[model samples]
Each structure stands twice: as structure tokens, then as C-alpha cells.
Target: MKIICTKSNLAKGVSIVSKAVPSKTTMPILECILIDATTDVIKLTANDMELGIETRIEGEIIDRGIIALNAKIFSEIVRKLPDNEIVIETDMNNQTMITCEKAKFNIAAQSGEDFSYLPVIEKEDNIAVSEFTLKEVIRQTIFSIADNDTNKMMTGELFEIDENVLKVVSLDGHRISIRKIELSDSYGQRKVIVPGKTLQEISKIIGGEAEASVEISFTKNHIVFEFDQTLVVSRLIEGDYFKIDQMLSSDYETKVRINKRELLDCIDRATLLIKEGEKKPIIINIGDESMKLQIKSQIGSMDEEILITKEGKDLLIGFNPKFLIDALRVIDDEEVDLYFMNAKAPCFIKDEQQSYIYLILPVNFNAVA
Candidate 1:
């Protein structure tokens, strides 16, 4: 394959598709990025079995052919190349040559025929969301996704579409994050479990422009995201997601309204006294007018008080400070409402409209104190 394109366009295409290149793969072809010049526009593709990305770049196709080159090497070469036109050509022996203004490199390439391409996904059940909204939703909930594979469902987020509402849910045993968004148009009901890795990659690629939009299509086993000149396809995690409704409660014995920044800062300061991997919990005592937060750890201790508007009854609870910080950091509200059911039930931070809901389980007061 032979293509002549500007360095900027080529580098952007390579960076977008390289996200799917597997770091450790048994299949050698999976580590390469396929460059297809048979069509009008140059197409770059990378697939690591579970996820695949394809992006089109404007370039002059001198030869109608295809080849797969090492993603790591190609990306590095393009990134370091001078700000000039780039020419890539492949020979009969699969030897690929990259040339810029004054630099040239020859690398071994593989046949594109053996490269795995993205699967065909039906575009029937789809919805359009602004890039800004989608990126914000992923950022707000991705931190709660489980890092381990112990529970596969918890490692991914639930994408549920009912009418014009899109609800995203993610949890990691300790806390649950839910974000609801309203779409401009309504579509068929669909539910899918999208892998956290896929969403994280898409978030990075999307520019989060309020005017730009992304079209998402969902099939039985695959989900497709199309935006700008790029397309991403990922296999959905199998099995039904956890029934989160049963775990979420609407009842609370005490409710307190506090400044979001004040509470977040208090918890963040308390974290300083606790060592890494320590199981210390931040104890919160809610009174009629103010809330006191205290943390005692091996290194030291912290005690602070923040004024709050209280309703219902007074309560005391303990929770992992990290969980609170994660939820609070993403919230854009100036003030937040906290609801508690005695001291053992989960604490909820949400607005009256329920646009965003964060549920964090409390630790035993005695266990920490």
C-alpha cells in the first residue's frame, strides 16, 4: 500500500486507532495497525479481539493496496517525524518504508488479509448524544468501576436506554454511581454492559464538544460508537447486570445539606493522616447545625467541622474517605444533599431530581474507632 498524507493527519489517525492495540497478544497481527488504501480515503484499523477501532484520514492513495505495520513503531515514527508530508509504501515482501522531509525508516510489515477487522454491527437500536455529555458521564462514573476481574459485571457499566433517557450505572462493591441523561430524540429500549476499557478509550478520543455528537448503536453482543471520522466497536460483557434497584433505597432517617466543596475538602484533608492501604474510616457526626468529621490513623489524626442544614434526625456514620472523595470530585453541584438511614445502611448523595445518585456503604463505627 502507498499513501501520501500530512504528518498531522497521519499522526492523529494512528493515535486514535492505537488505543485498541493489545499490549500483550499471542497473535502477532493483533499488534499491528492495518493501513488500507483501496478506498478513496486512507483507513487505519487496529483490533485486539475485544475492542476494535477504525479511522479515516484524508490522503492521496498512490497504490490501491493494504498492509499491516507495527503500531508502536509506526506511531513513534510518525510522532517524531518533521512537520511535513509523510509517504508510506509497502513492497511485495511486506517491507514498509516511511519517509518524511529528511528522515526515512524501513520496517517489516504483515499482510493485511490476515488482520482481524471490526465486526459488522446492526444500526437499528441507536441513539445520538453530544460528545460533551457522553464524556462527562464516563468521567463521573468510570472511577467506581471495579479494577479487578473477580466480578466481571462490576468491571463494566450498565448502559440502559428507555425512551429518551440514558442511564449509566457503575459500581465496585463499595460504592455505586448512577448518571441519567436526556437525549434529544427517543429510540427503542436497549440494555447492554459496555466494558470499562472501551468507554475510557472513547472518552479520551472524544473532544467533548457540546455541538459535536456521537452515534451509538447496540446489538446483542456488540456496541458501536461513531463520531467524527472515527468508529469504535467493542464486545459487550455477557450475562445480566446486577439488579441495582434492590440495593438502592429511598428511605432515610436523617438528611443534611452541606456545601459540596467544604465536605470534599474535609474528607481530602482527613485522607492525609491515613496511610496508603490503611482501612481507616472517616467518622462523621451530624448534629442540628453542623457536621464534624474525624479520622484517627497510625500517622496522626484530623478533626474538622462544617456547618450544614439538617432535617429529620441526627445521625453518626463512618465511611472510607476515598469513596466519598471519588463521588464528590465529579459532582458539579455547589451544594449536595446527604441522606442516611441510621448508621449501618448506605448513605446517598443526590439531587432532588435524581439526575445523579451516589451510594456509599458505611463501615462499622466500632471497627474504625
Candidate 2:
């Protein structure tokens, strides 16, 4: 198989599919990138069983054949090659030659017939969303997913589609992040749990073009994302998601409306006095029209006050500063509303429309340093 591709196009295709290449795999074929030039377009594919990616590049296919090359070496070679056309040819002895203007390198290749390909998914149950919106949603919620595998469901996000509204939710034991988006067209109701790894990779690959759309299709156990010249297929996490609606409440005895940036910066500064891995809660005293934040740790102590519009009742609460920072960093609003039910109940940070909601469980101040 022989194909002549420009360095820029080939490098882009390789970089996009390389996300699926496994760092360590018992099967060597899983570490290679399959190049299929038998069709009109030059296709590159990489699959690590759980996730698979395929992208087409614009190039000239001189010979109709297929070969698999090591993804690491191939990507490095293409990236370092001169900014010109690159010729890749495979011979009968399973040897692949990469040539540029003056540089040439030969590497062993594997037959593409032995490579595993992405599963074929039916496009009947599908939804179209703007590339920009999809990327933004993932960025705003992926951070809250559990990093451990003790609870499999916590490592993934729930994708629920009800008519024209799409809701994405991710939660760890300590906090929950929810983002709801409105779609342009309505479709059948569907719900699935997508692995966090797949969404993270897709976010990096998407160009974030507000006008461009991404077609997403779901089956019983698989999900597919198609955008531009690339496609991503991932295995769905099987199980029922948590009933989050019951945990959300609109009742609050106290409410505070404060500048988002000011509160975030105050929490950020308080965290500096606390040491890593130390259980020091940021104690907040909410009064009539102001809130005071204080933190005491082994290293030192800090106290600050921020003016807020308060109503309902005055209260004292304690929370993990990291949780507050995480939710605040993702929010784009100039001011945010916080609802509290006594000092033990979880805090709710959101807007009036409820487009985004963050629930953070409070820490016990008596036990915290």
C-alpha cells in the first residue's frame, strides 16, 4: 500500500486518532494505527477495545492496500518530518518505508487484516448538537467525576435526552454537577452513561466551532460521535444512573447573592493558608448583608469579608474550599445565588433559570481543624 499525504494533513489525522492508543496492552496490534487506503479516502484507525477513533485524511492513494504501523513511531516521524509531502509505501515483506524530501526510514508493519475495527452502530437514535456546546458541557462537568473505580457509575456521566432538552450530570460522593442544554430539534427519549475518558478525548479533538454540529448516535451498549472527518465509538457503562431529582431541593432558609469573582477569589486566598491533605473547612458566617470567611490551619489563619445581598435567615456553615472553587471556576455568570438549609444541609449554587446546578456537601465544623 502506498499513499502520498501532506505533512500537515497526515500529522493532524495521526494526532487525533492517537488518543485511543493504549499506553500498555498485551496485544501489540492495539498499539498500532491501521491505515486503510483501499477506498477513495485515506482512513486511519486506532482502537483500545473500550474506545475507538477513525479519521480520514486528504491524500493520494497510489496503491489499494492496507497496513498497520506503530502509532508512537509513526506520529513522531510525521511530526518531525519537513513541512512537505510525505510518501508512505509498504512492500510484500511487511516492511513500511517513510520518505520525505531528503530523509527516509524503514519500519516493520503488521497486516491490517488482523486489526480490530470499530463496531458498526445504527444511526436511527441520534441527536445533533453544536460542536461548541458539546465541548463546553464536557469541560464544565468532567472534573466532578470520580477518579477511583470503587463505584463504576461515579466514573461516568449520565446523558439523558428528553425531547428537545438534553441534560448531562456527573457526581462524586462529595459533590454533583449538572448542566442542561436545549437542542434545536426534538427526538425520542434516550438515556445512557458515557465514560468520562471518552468525553475528555472528544473535547480535545473538537474544534469548538459554534456553527458546526456533531452527530451522536446511541445503541443498547455503544455510543458513537461523528463530526468533521472523524468518528469516535465508545462502550457505554451499563447500569441505572442515580435518581438525582430527589436529591435536588428548591427549599432554602437562607439565600445569598454575591459577586462570583469576589467569592471565588476569597476562597482561593483562604486555601493558601491550608496545607494539602489537611481537613480544614472554610467556615462562613452569613449575616444580614455580609458574609465573613475564615480558615484556621497548622500553617496559619486567614479571615476575609465580602458584601452580599442576603435574605431569609442568618446562618453559619462549613465546606471544603476545593469544592466551592471547582464550581465557581466553571460558572460564567457575574453573580450567583447560594441556597442553604441550616448548616448541615448541602449548599446549592445556581442561577434563576437553573441552567447549571452544583450541590456540595458541607463538612462538620466541630470535627474540622
Candidate 3:
């Protein structure tokens, strides 16, 4: 295979595809990136069996052929090459020669036949979303997905598409983050569970440009996300996602409205005195006009008072300070609404606009009834 391309364009294309190349794998062929060259476009593809990315760069293809080269060596060499036109050609003996203005490098290459076949994006059941809106939606919810390997389904975010709204929900069994955005055009109905890493990468690849658009769709086992000259095909977390409808309680006896920044600060300050491995959860006392957040550890403690509008009798509850702070950081609204079903039941939180709902399973402090 042979191709000539500008340094910056090649560097950008290789950098994105390299994210899927496995650093170490038992199979030897998985370490190489498959490069396909035609007269008009050059395609670079890499996969670690779980996630894969393919990018097409606009370059002059001298010959129509395929070659697989070591991803590590090729990427490193291209990144440092001068910002001038570079030429890469493969010899009959499977050796790749990289040439720049004053430097030449030779490395052994392999045929593309040895590489695994990447999954094809079969159906184009597409949806349209602006780059900025989708990027912000993923940023607001991706942090709360589970880090451990307990329940496989819970480790990823549940994305549902129906009619005119796209919803993202993530839970670690203790705290759940739910977000919703109205669609620009009705795209019919579809549902898929995308892994957290894929969502994070796509969020970054979008580059926060509001004018750009992403074409989204899915097959049975994979999801295809297409953007400007870049495509990400990620394996889906196939299974039934837990139903959030029944998981959250509908009955509420108390409601408190407070400033979002003030509540987040109160929880962060309370967490400072609570030492690691200590059972010192933050105690929240809610009344008619004010709310108090306090934490008492062995050596130190914190007391914070925030103004609020409450509508029921006074109540006190215990919650993990770290979890509370995490949920608060993702909210974009200025004010937050808190719901209670007693001191022992799970507490629900929503923005002042009531657009999205968050639930936290409270810690039991009183003796069992």
C-alpha cells in the first residue's frame, strides 16, 4: 500500500484510531492497525474486540492495496514527523518505508488478511443530535456509572430513544442520575445501552462544536456513531436494564427547595471532617425554613446552614457525603428540589424546573422497626 498525506491530518487520524488498539493482547495480529488505501481515501481501523474506531483521511493514494503495521511504532513515527507531506510505501517483502523531508524509517509490515474482521454497520436507523447538546448530556451522566465489575448491565449508561426525547440514566445502586433533552425532530423509536467508555470518547471527539451534527444508530450488538470523517462502533451491553419507574418512590411527604451551589458546598465541607473508613455520614436536618448539614468525626466536625423552603414537619436523615456531592456536581440548574418519604425511605432529588429526577438510597440510622 502507498499513500501521501499532510502531517497534521495523518497525525489526527492515527491518534483517534490508536485509542482502540490494545496495548497487549494474547493474539499477535491484534496489535497491528489495518490500513486500506484507495485512490481517493485512506482508511485506518483498530479494534480490541470490545470497541473499535475507523477513520478516513483525505489523501492521495498512489496504489490500491492493504497493509497492517504495528500501531505503536507507526503512530509514534507519524506524530514526530515534520509538518510536511509524508509518503509511506510497502515493499514486496512486507516492509513499510516512511519518508519525510530529511529522514527515512523502515519497519516490517504484515498483510491485512491476518487482522480480524471489524463489525459492519448494517442498518442506518439514524437520529440527529447537535454536537454541543449530546456532548453535554454525556458529560452530565457518565461520571456516575459504576466502576466495579459487579452487575454488568449497571456498569454502563442506559440510553432510551422514543419519539422526541433522549434520556440518559446511570446508577451504582446507591445514587442514580437521570437526564432528558427534547429532540429537534421526531426520529421514531429506538433503545440501546452504550458502554461508558464509548460515550466518554465520543463526547471528546465531538470537540464541543455546536454547529456539528452526529448521526446515531444501532444494530443488534453494536452502535454506530458517525461524525466528521470519524466513526465509532461500540459493543452494546445487551440485557434488560433495571426499570427506574418502580425503583423510585412516588409518595412524598416533605419538599425542600435550596440553591444548588449552596447544597453542594455544604456536603463537600461536611466530608472534610469525616475520615476515611469512618461511619460518620452527613446528617441532614430539614425544617420549614432552613436546612442543616452536619458531620461529627472523632477529631473534628462541620456545621452548615442553608436557607430553604420546606412544606412539612421537620425530619432528619443520614446520607453518604461523597455520593451527595457527586450527584450535585452534575446538575446544571441553579436550584434543586428535595423529596422525602420519611427518614428511612430513599430520598429523591430534582432540579427546580423538575425536568430531571435523581434518587439516592439513604442510609438507615434508626433501629429496625
Candidate 4:
């Protein structure tokens, strides 16, 4: 294979496909990226069995062929190449040569036949979403996915699509995050559990183009994402997602409307005195038109008050500062409503439209210092 492409374009293509290359795998071919040169387009592909990524870059194809190169070394070399066009070729001896301006390097190449092919999804069942909106939805709920959980399904998010409305949900035992959006076009009804790691990588690839759209398709066991010049396929976790709607209740003994940033800042400051791994609870005493936040730890204590517009009965609740901070940080709203039923039930934080709902289980004050 012989191809010539600009340094920036080559680097970008390599970066996108490298996410699928496994850092440690028994199959050596899985660590290498397959570079295929056709008549006018140069394609790069990487697959780790479960997740696969393929992208094409516009380049001058001198020789139409294919070769596999070490992704780690190839990416580093392309990233540091001189600000000039890069020429890559594989000789008969199976050695890959890279040249850009004055720099040159030779590395052993592997046969592209050894690399596994990416899964191909039939496009009959597909949905379209704005790139910016999908990125935002993933960002808003991905954090709530359980990390290293024994129940593998909890480590992923639920993509529940009904007609034109799409709802994304993630929960980690302690809190549940749900974000719903209405799509411009409908793809009927579908539900799938997408791994959190896959969404994390997809979010990175999506640039800040709000108008650009992503085409998504789901099969029996895998989900496919296509946008721009890239394609991603990820295996879906098999299990029924928890019925989260029943858990989110509108019953509340107290409702307070407060500034999201102000509450976030107060909880963040209170956590300063708490040490790592310590289960410190930020006690919130909600009163009429105002609330006081306090945290007590072995190092010291912190207390602050923020004014709010309160209704119903007064309540005092304790919660993990990190949980509250996580929800508040992602919210783009200026004012938010916090609903509570005494101090035992979960607290709900959401906007007026209820487009995004965060239900956090309060910390048991009896167990904290």
C-alpha cells in the first residue's frame, strides 16, 4: 500500500480509529490498525472484537493496497510529522516505510488479512439525531452509570426510543439520571443498552457542530453509530433495564426553587473538609425562603446558607456531596426545583419541563460523623 496525505488529516483519522485498538490483548492484530488504500480514499480500521471503528481520509493513493501497522507507534509518528504531506508505503519484504519532509522511519508490517472485519449493520432500523444533542444527552447521564459493577447491565445506559421521543437513562444504585428529547424524525419504537465506554468515546469524536446529524442503527445484539466520515459499532449488554419511571414520584413534602450554580458551589465548598473515601454527608436544612448547608468531618466543618423560594413543609436532608455536585454541574438551567419527602425518600432535582430528572437517595445522617 502506498498513499500520500496531509499531516493534519492523517493524524485526525488515526486518532478517531485508535480508540478501538486494545491496549492489552492476546490477539496481536487487534493492537494494529488496518490501513487500506483504494483508488482515491485511504481507510483506517481498528477492532477489539466488541467495539469497532472505521474512518476514511481523502488522500492521493499512489498504489491501491492494504497493510496493518502498530496503532500506537503510527499515531505518535503521524502526530509529530513535519508540517508537510506524509508518504507511506509497504515494500515486498512486509516492512512499512513512513516519510515526511526530512524524517523517515521503517517498521515491520502485518498482513491486513489477519485483522478482523468490522461488523456490518443493516440500515433498515435507523434513527437520526443532532450531533450536538446526542453529545449533550450522553454527557448529562453517562456519569450515573455504575463503575466496575458485578451486574454488567448497570455499567451501561438505556437508550429507550418511542416514536419521536428519545429517553436516555443511567443509574448507579444511589442516583438515577434521565434525559429525554424529541427527535426531528421518528424511527418507531426501540430500546437498547449501550455500554458507557462506547458513549464516552463517541462523545469525544462529535465536534461542536449542532446542525450535524448522527445516523444510529440497532440490531439484535449491537448498536451502530455513523456520522461525518466515521462509523462505530458496539456490542449491547443483554438485560432488562430497571423500570425507572415508577421510582420517580411527584409526591413531596417540601419543594424549593433555587439557583443551580449557587447550590452547586455551596456543596462543593462543604466537601473541601471531607477526605477521600470518607462518606461525608452535606446536611441541608431547608427553611422558608432560605436553606443552610453544613458538613462535618474529622478535619473540620463547613456551613453556609443560600436563599430559596420554598413551599409546602420544611425539611432537613443529608446527601453525598459528589452526587449533588454531579447533577448540578451538568444542568444548564439557571433556576431548579428540589423536591423532597422528609429525609428518607430520594430527592428530585429538575427543571420546570422535567426534561432532565435527577433522583438522588439521601445519605443516612445516623451513619455519618
Per-residue accuracy of model 1 over 93-168 as CA lDDT, tens digit each:
9999999987999999999999998897776678899999999999999999999999999999999998899999
Q: Each prediction's TM-score against the native?
A: 0.98, 0.98, 0.92, 0.98
Candidate 4 regions off by >4 Å?
none
* Residue runs of model 1 more than 4 Å from their true location after superposition: none
Off by more than 4 A, model 2: none
lDDT by residue (tens digit), candidate 4, 1-369: 789999988999999999999989998899999998854678999999989999999889988888999999999999888989999999887799999999999999899877898977776588888899999999999999999868798899999999898999999999999999998887678889999989999999988488898989899999999999999999999989999888989888899999888999889888889889999899999998899999999999888999999999988889999999999999998989999988999999987778999999998887875
TM-score for candidate 2: 0.98
- Clashing residue pairs, backbone N/CA/C < 3 A, model 3: none
Compute the lDDT of residue 22 as modeled in candidate 1.
98
Q: Where does candidate 1 clash, by residue pair? A: none
The 10-residue segment of model 1 with minimum total lDDT is: 117-126
Q: Model 4, poorest ten-residue lDDT window?
A: 119-128
lDDT of 1: 0.94
Candidate with top lDDT is 2
Structure candidate 4, residue pairs in collision: none
